[model samples]
Target: MARKISAPSLFQLGYYWEAKIFLTSVKLDLYTPLAKGPKTAKNLAGLIEADTDALTRLLDALVSIGLLRREGDAYANIPELAEFLAKTSRFYMGELMLLQDAEWDHWGKLEDIIKTGKPTVQDNIFMNTPELGATVSKVLHRMAKRVAPALAEKIDLSDYKTLIDVGGGGGAFTIAFCQRYPHIKASLFDLPQTLKVAQENIAQAQLNHRIELIEGNFNTGPLPGTYDVVFASDILHYQTEAENAALVKRLYDATEPGGFIIIKDMFIDDDENEPGWNAVFSIHMMVYSEKGRCFQGKKIRDWMTQAGFDNIVEIEKNTILAGTKGV
Candidate 1:
């Protein structure tokens, strides 16, 4: 008989063992079967090509982990996991799992990384080659495209004529916005190699006519002052606190008076203990970046105030931070 394992010690390890199981299920496309409706054990086994007995246990394990729900003789996808984990869902977060999987290999080297304080990206299989990075960037763009349009609804973006996506990987955000607001022209700022994928995504979205592509590192170069709204999503976590302040200042200068700067990223709670997701992401950043991690909204508000942006507002809880430059 196999000895039963206990829940991972929260203080000893940052990640729970169940996270590993969930990600494995995601990789195997196990969530897709239940996206449409619940499935019987035999049906799910056929879909996954696994033994029915093993598959039943697998489904039960998933349910225990809160990613799936089993009612009587039927098993169904949990709504949150169904929407985000299933590849068929529009808001699918499979790419986020890809990102996580890329980092998973490096978890073995966590001790070394902790002692050396260096990124394991190059050594890991997921980020070793430029081509792989580009591929991951494209996947990330698809994820962003799914997320941005939903945000456009509540915000008043009518006055803005141009949207500049800074470090905009894959240009999905720009594609979504341009498609929704036909009058708004879009510009994507990224390295040439990365922008190539963005160009392809734009063509896929059929927004090529309304978008312009610019190639350069925004960190080393001065931001051009023509855009009405400057946006950064899931990019700033790569920079240090001082770099974030400088970048915000640059965006403040680049925007015309009355224009807005929008930042979309995971925000830590004020006390830094809430939002378990944000806290876990901070650990992930420690593995990927030397100095960056999930930032607090208070810090973002302070950055806006210091950068001369007025009317700073936390845009709901979508991890969006927005502020307008003085008119």
Candidate 2:
């Protein structure tokens, strides 16, 4: 059923108090110390060099939100969340939250942007700050460990011999694709700085020979070479519709006949109200990017069709699409 609402619920929706508190905890690395053992607010404050009373209030608030547990005066990190929140854990996802914490100030310009039809930032994170962008990409890679492998399961790449991962930050998708399809050679393409980080990842995966690192911006020129599969994952949302369409068209051009082009991105419903995540993400894009916005699926499919792709299918609803370049 569609989300039902009441007056109180509507009011609750406006509250971002819990979100900010949670983000604050992640930013402060509070969970790391708590992971060692339960600690009093004073102990935590002394370690972090913050006021004891204020840290107590914040810790109590975290208890209220179920992220921490309190017994008397000591607070403990929730066992399950510690896997993701503890700095020593292999699965720590603090970096992604740090990125959000960094961008919190840009959201302050939302009202002014809405009124003036302008953005707070000149470019998206990837283009404006490559170092931070590379780190954030690695964080996302760890957070969604199954994303690319799952995509590999969905798409049939058995016959394809080569692939190009456009804007392939950290080479996550390329790594997954090559791992799943051993016969295929892959190219991971992105800015030079991002490729350096990807190089380290590829080496760690021991796939340096199977995956080639190609350094170039996809937006500045045509992709370096044609391939059996041109896969641009999680990249289109950072551009205007015109740029997205043009990129899709280029993907079609680079795709060899009898092969495919795939774009994986958040596509909002035409009514612009459901899949609540993408809807709100569109607003985030508008505030943080000069032209980025979540787009409608059919609009992008139409561009693919216009570019002469045949047998197009939406492999996942409003998320991924695969189009064939007819022989």
Candidate 3:
């Protein structure tokens, strides 16, 4: 059963005051200057060109939220957060925050989108801004490095000879798989611009000779070569169910005899209302995408069955849908 919310909790849920405060600070870049040393609100206002009186309240609010620390006359970024929040920090995640800031405007139209069933933005961030897409690709690569290793650990790829990562961004999973299994030669296929990031990442990993980078759109593709394993991760959410079904059929067709078809995505349960994150993400898609939304695991299971797959199984419940081609 789901937990019931109290009055205060419900109020807090409706209140986005603190979220806006943090995103606003990210936009202001207040952490960068504070990383050098603490500053009074007046000093910060002068640096970022914010109004002194208004900036003081925001800084105090940041302190209350534990993002900032205030003492005597100055405020500073919390030590742990400064590592990622500060613009000058090597581990900075300001880009991701900036991305949320960009979406802030779109999310405001959630009501209108719900009523009209129209997307707020014409194109996703990648299509509208190539430069930002490249930076986000790098950020995502760094994050996926932490996750792909675990996923690699889950799936046994020791016997798989050739693998294609359909819509693989920046070669994160491909790199992890190649590193885990020495005999595996892989293909990293994605859009032309996204593949540039993949090329740089593959070269850095020194697997350039082993992993061939293919530049094309997966939606309009005759993917090159049959493979022992065809893995699609985090790409299905961008397209419609029919599109994804067609994609799955294509992947199944491209699979070698006795090969595996793996699809990894944030999937909802049959109800599509139980998983909170995916439920919210459904609305996110409604606001941002023309034909994107979270799907049920059953949808993939049906697609797999329809595509003439055998030995179908969801290896990670809703997160990973896997099936084997009959020998």
Best by lDDT: 3
**Candidate 3 lowest-lDDT run of ten:** 271-280
Candidate order by TM-score, highest to lowest? Answer: 2, 3, 1
Regions of candidate 1 where Cα sits further than 4 Å from its true position: 1-98, 111-129, 273-276
Mind giving the per-residue lDDT tens digits that candidate 1 earns over 1-327?
Answer: 223445765433565677777777887788787887888999888888889997788778888878888877989888876888888987777766766776687677879987987876532222245576687786787667667788776667888898898988898778778877889998898877788898888888888889989887677757865578988887767677898888888878788787898888888777644554676777777776466577887887888789998888888773888988777
What would the TM-scores of all predictions be? 0.72, 0.96, 0.94
**CA displacement after TM-score superposition, residue 178 of candidate 2 (Å):** 0.7
Candidate achieving the largest TM-score: 2
- Report the C-alpha displacement of residue 206, candidate 2, in angstroms: 0.8
Candidate 2: residue 184 lDDT (0-100) = 95
Worst 10 residues of 1 by lDDT: 121-130
**Clashing pairs in model 3, backbone N/Cα/C closer than 3 A:** none
> Candidate 2 regions off by >4 Å?
271-276
Q: Model 3, residue 276: displacement in angstroms?
A: 3.4
- Candidate 1 vs candidate 2: which has greater lDDT? 2
